[model samples]
Target: MSKAFSAIDEDREVDRDAFTPGVEPQPTWCPGCGDFGVLKALKGAMAELGKDPEEILLATGIGCSGKLNSYFDSYGFHTIHGRSLPVARAAKLANHDLEVVAAGGDGDGYGIGGNHFMHTARENHDITYIVFNNEVFGLTKGQTSPTSPKGHKSKTQPHGSAKSPIRPLSLSMTSGASYVARTAAVNPNQAKDILVEAIQHDGFAHVDFLTQCPTWNKDAKQYVPYVDVQESDEYDFDVTDRREAQELMTETEEALYDGTVLTGRYYQDEQRPSYQAEKQSRGDMPEEPVAKRYFDDDYEWERSFDVIDRHK
Candidate 1:
């Protein structure tokens, strides 16, 4: 185990309320917003794992999801649009001990920020990334989001969107996420359990969180009466096998627009090393926190100019 997780006191009991902001302001998200479920599940998962709030770092991009850190009370960075992943990556690189998480809406993550999403997964950064997919941009007055269904009308696409929705689970798997799963607001218990596992996972964990936007996405199909593939005998596939998981993900993505909401773990690679792990193995990364090196007066560090002078 890395020093990050090994430092935690397993017997310590962390209260869920410890995550609440000092002001304890209620979330400003629209009533019945799917984001509420995510917040609850996160708090529950952290508490269940006995993680201290101080050890966590939540980085969120522009949109309603960015408000998460305000309510989560963790070390937070409310970043610019479609840039949470890079920001989160920098933090993890500087201080690998922090349990980092990045969050954003579908439009923020899958649309404008898609490039970052792909590379971050390909590198297998050690962080949890949650994409709140509501099909429309609720905070921006109900525009078509990246996950919006074909023929789904919005202010931006008044005649209805012609673009096929991005297959997030498939994309995550293809881009090289070590862990991938889908969960919904309607299933809080399952969501909580998944979050716990995702946070516990050692590599890049991507969760396509289905969130309902009642005000903006009233046209969205209700996520109720969902099927859990893990518990259902009808669906049996090993999460560790790439071939099996790939086929299952393809079906699940198609089933979503067809009105069948399939939510569950799709794939995991416990053997894959994370980006930091690879760097450490190559001797390119320091075993201790890079931030800590600044405080060590005895530590000699090479300057950028020194390397340039040597080469000249």
Candidate 2:
């Protein structure tokens, strides 16, 4: 069998509208929901890159953010809460040619699936991970989430949440994500640009997207008047420098709670090799992807019965 199944049609021009499902089901997200911004930026990025919907695989975890796959016209898996990363990692390893992107809310990504997020970054998996940081758990009726600022009152914390919020960008860098960035739903242009860079990165990329929950978290900032670190003269740091990135990320995290919304690429390590490439270099993984073998009708497949007989 030919490898035509994985080939990209470079001759064709891809449109942003192509990613929108033909039978557009009316979106159920509430009016002024920041989730809509994520969808728009994602589609714009894919279209700008000239990527066909067939070439991409989007995996999402449970929460309001999980509905992203439903709106995006691409191969998708809506996995259990906090499990999108692992599923996305498996799919990427199976078919290295597929453009893998994982998304989830703060509670899903930072609370439940945090371990997977850290390890995936540490291993430098070639995947883009977008976390919708809306502070509270929107789908579950405004409960305190892992990213919720300290003292922020929610249904789960009626008086106030004493616990501090996770510094996502700094944590991602320390855990070993090659590309670390922060973008807000309020700034679609910057979000699209960052998404483009994240998708193009060869190693693990983590984007802490600040999405406001207008309906659930009334106290949450809409993330307006955001200053892009790259554009602002007030902020200056090298994205390739670990120490610089760390300092800036810490500042950004602190500033968010203090009413300053700073958004931009924080770190990128171009020299680091992705997990798949490292495995291949060590002769551990096959040159031909596992996905391709499944499509080959003539390829031999070992049977469970044969293994049992051999063991016996």
Candidate 3:
């Protein structure tokens, strides 16, 4: 999918509209799709952070979320299924200055992409990962996803799902993500704020965004009147407390199926050094961006490519 692409100038003052493509293509996601909320919140977060479109790299996998790069005006890669994290990690490694983000659906991220998600978090990579958790494979015509509720009925499992849903927040916390959050599409303000914090975070930040699929999974409960863990007087837990966060996340994950949707930032670790920073501190990573070296030696690399071709 490599092709010549142009970038927006860096010196221009960052505006919300700067992220919109010059020739904007209308999103094909179904009307009332929760994806629209994500797009809006993301644009708002980027604008708030004063991030130029050229300074960010958005990597997406094969799912409805993959179309994000097409609509958002940024340096992007539409990677293969379950591969967005690897691509995002590579981009971050090559240029620490680039803001890297990976987005995918629950099926794409928690199923086949589960391994990458685990290791990336374990390594504390410097990137923001957004998993659109709508409870089904929206792009594959509403199949049961890894996060689908137990006993949920789908075409793939007309008898209902026999397996329990994987606890995303618990998994993320246990897997070593430095920053963890859960936000819903129904709450755009909170979503934007969480995204802003996630992007600014230096270590791996995993946001399990609860999106609604109106066309599919009609049996799901309406996601409204959610309680923000941060704003609610009923729930009190320190955001920096891992054990407390784990307990709260368990309840939050369970409540989703019990007709209560809880949304908010649950955990954050500020002292942990990111994978890049740790490597650079040990003199393992280059002082300057590796991309600069690649560009400067482009002609020599091309000659080497020709030499390999002759051997073949």
> How close to the true structure is residue 267 of candidate 3, measured as C-alpha lDDT?
95
Q: What is the C-alpha lDDT of each candidate?
A: 0.91, 0.91, 0.89
Tens digit per residue, CA lDDT, model 3, 1-312: 112112322434467788899999989999878888888889999988878887889999988888988989989999999999999999999878788899999999999899999999999999999998899999889999999999998999999999999999999989999999999888999999999999999999999998888888776644887999999998899889999999999999999898899999999999999999999998778676666554554434335455344553
Off by over 4 Å in 2: 1-4, 9-11, 302-312
Q: Mind sharing the TM-score for model 3?
A: 0.91
lDDT of 2 by residue, 1-312 (tens): 433345454556789999999888788788888999999999999998889888899999999999999999989999999999999999999888889999999999999999999999999999999999998899988999998889998778989999999888888999999999999999999999999999999999999999988999877759877999999999888989999999999999999888889999999999999999999998767877788887788999867675344543
- C-alpha positional error of residue 190 in candidate 1 after TM-score superposition, expressed in Å: 0.8
* Superior candidate under TM-score, 2 versus 3: 2
Q: Could you tell me the TM-score of candidate 2?
A: 0.95
Ranking by TM-score: 2, 1, 3
Q: Residue 215 deviation, candidate 1, in Å?
A: 0.3
C-alpha lDDT (0 to 100) for residue 225 of candidate 3: 73
lDDT of 1 by residue, 43-62 (tens): 99999998888789999999
